[model samples]
Target: MVTMTSPAETAPTPRLLALRDAVREIERHAADRGWDGEVTASVFALVRTTDALSATPDLAGELPETALAEAASDPEHLTSIEQDGLPEATTLEELLAQLAWPEQVDGAAVVVERLMVPPEAEQGLPQDPEEAMAALMAHPDRTDVRLAAGVLRTGESWCAVRSRSHDTDDEVAGSPEAVPGLVEALRATFR
Candidate 1:
């Protein structure tokens, strides 16, 4: 007789669960700040709780003894550390291309807002980057989107996207491969 496996048996690993939680936490934090339509992105570094505690001893005061003990012992536990704001003029791709993480940085995440239009709207976009952006922003059918993506050095990834039209916690969607390009870019920083 063969024993059958169910969907529950194929659940994501603990590391993935932690990554998802961290991504959502950051997403909600961004949402709390309210949308400002800023071009600069907010970036963060995800480190092991143990590492974060060691690197920044001040964090110890923020957690209770039991919580600190658990975080110190749980290798899968992670904490998010927001990095400096990106320069307004620099594109994410350009900034990502120049990034090299320190040894202690286990992963990285970014929250960015962009104006998106249907594929057809991009057909006649100008060749110049500035012109293209202006065209996209001026498009009548554009949608504002806030995307949060994170990647771990161990090859796990998570993404959350919230559109301004449905800007609610319950409406935010998340998945491992929801935004492949952003995931890939974040992963490159680990290398």
Candidate 2:
């Protein structure tokens, strides 16, 4: 008579092994890049999983339980694995067959873009006036809209400074003294 093995006794599947390898590759890349800051942090926030087998709670685990537990509890490991970049394969079939999942890859791209690119107003602003405005407006907790408004206000003040300096022949348009007042004004608005 033939006997059937229980699910618990079954060997790990090839797909699962591939997935584990992909995760490991991502973690290695993240470590190499020193990606422990805002970008990786955001990626961790987005793709974090509660699965017992997928989490990386420990730095090194000799047993399955310890490894699984380590993965689950360690946000840094999970974030690094989820956010690391992947190379683009030639074909969709090749890509699909090679990686964990397309959704995970796409999510990582979104996190990278959001972290790397400054918002619209901050992009292509003039070096002296615009950069000064951006510096004046930046805040740790402010929303993008609020920050943009601050940028606009600072830009207007810079324009005024430029006009006044031109009229007076004082060259105060790009002077260091102008930045403090604008920065103070921006800080006051937040209050």
Tens digits of per-residue lDDT, candidate 1, 35-140, equal 9745368889998888778878999998668657767667777788888755444578878867778888888888888788999999988999999999998999
Model 1 scores a C-alpha lDDT of 0.83
| lDDT string, candidate 2, 1-191, tens digits | 11112467565343333223323333333334432344422121123233322544352343346444644565322222332464465532333234333333211211111112245545554679767566635634323210000111112211112121122323212211233433343333322
Task: State the C-alpha lDDT per candidate.
Answer: 0.83, 0.30
| Root-mean-square deviation of candidate 1 | 5.3
Candidate 2 lands at a TM-score of 0.21
Clash counts per candidate, in order, are 0, 7
Off by over 4 Å in 1: 1-9, 37-39, 54-57, 63-75, 85-89, 126-134
- The pairs that clash in candidate 1 are none
